[model samples]
Target: MVNCKNCGTNITSKFCPDCGQPAALKRIDAHYITHEIEHVLHFERGIFYTIKELITAPGQNVKNYISDNRSRLVKPIIFIIVTSLLYSLVAHFFHTEEKYIKSVDARTIENQFVITSKIFQWLQNHYGYANIIMGLFIAFWAKLFFRKYNYNFFEILILLCFIMGMSMLMYGFFAIIEGMTHTNLLMYATALNFLY
Candidate 1:
């Protein structure tokens, strides 16, 4: 057996048993850089499959994850982070909240609308934190409603994280559409998302 280049330990496999590093670290050359970038951008597994499973069979996905098939699905915390980042990026690039505010009739605002706008702005600015807090509430509510499911708090939290992460993307786009069209599309989206 040869010593692992990474940790100088006897390793018979391609990876170091102790640290999980490759036994033979590749040189930092053009080929290695190209391969690494390609693997991250093209071959890496995430997002698409996560969203697909969340959409197609959320309950099954949750069950599978809790029942020892965890490796097949993305981790709930990572999914939440990724989806939150996506939501922030889309909201910033498109200015959906600003558009929505502008689309509102001035007459409708009258006198008290300034405070309402301020509240909306605060909510938008702290959306990531708000989402996490909301997920906690959602998990509690689901646990209460689905008592027969017999899931504990943390387990239900994981399920809600995956469920909310998937639906958040839809809410982002629906807001964009509502802003662009100056329509009441958000009302319908809100109803749909509530049931989601």
Candidate 2:
């Protein structure tokens, strides 16, 4: 048996049980750089499959995720982040953000808003602390109500995050549709989010 390069652990199987590294290591070369770049771009199986699985059959994905079939699906937090980034990018580059900012009446606010960071302004001058606190409440209630399921607050929080992420993706898709049609479909999007 060879020692694991990662942690010097003894290996009996193809992978080290302790560090989970493979028994063999490839030599560094131009191929290594090419492989690294490919990994970064996920030329192999990656985010596209995750997004497709989530979008097409969220119920099965969530069920599988909760049941520990996570290899195929992206992490809930990662899904949230990617969708949020996509929405932000679309808003930024497509002048949607400018439209929203211009629409907001600065005169209506009586010196309450402080210009601190670009992100703050981009989020419509809202820190969204209320939403976080409310999410905690929802998690707590979910844990209490679903006692038979035996999910802890953290687990419920993850589940809620997954649901929210899915909704965010839907909103992003709706925004794109609205943008293409040059119509105010986001009014419907807002209602959909509220209902979701």
Candidate 3:
């Protein structure tokens, strides 16, 4: 006899005595229900609005948001969400060459590193591409200039996230220009950076 999945009582009926849950689970539907659609719409609206505000307003938005008495600006988590979206768009647009030409007498992971660096360089060129570089500067500035802030390094990181998040709006604008021009600024930036 087939045993009841729920309550583990002997199979007499479909449901078990302990609880009224189904003994046999129903198969999942191919299409999601309206409830799922509502949930997705709700989530997407929040993200879209947040990205719009964050990208458009930057510092003013952050100041009026995290400090002032308003609740409409995008949350901090949205920064990561939009960043991931930008990364996804970049990944889709930038396809690496899979074919590797064998060197005369040496085999190294140089090709893979080059490809990875290219992607990072591309991202940096577009999104304030100098974000990490500027971040280091900001980090140093916070250490020395803001010595009276009385905050630790970790606290500075939190502040930097906001500062950089705001600065990244500029990066996004440049990304649009680069995308339209069909030119990768990263190539030039990489050359200059390497030369230094």
lDDT, model 3, position 118:
64
Kindly list the per-residue Cα lDDT of model 3 for residues 13-115, writing each as its tens digit: 7776667766777666645465544443354445456556655665565556645634564444445435544643543354211111112222265465666
List the candidates' TM-scores in order.
0.67, 0.66, 0.40
Better of 2 and 3 by TM-score: 2
Clash list (residue pairs), candidate 1? none
lDDT of 1 at 61: 79
Please report how far candidate 2 places residue 25 from its true position, in Å.
5.6
Indicate which candidate wins on TM-score: 1
Minimal lDDT window, size 10, model 2: 124-133
Cα shift from native, residue 61, model 1 (Å) = 1.6
Task: State the TM-score for model 2.
Answer: 0.66
**Worst 10-residue lDDT window, candidate 1:** 37-46
Per-residue accuracy of model 2 over 27-76 as CA lDDT, tens digit each = 99999999765543362335566667666786777777887676666666
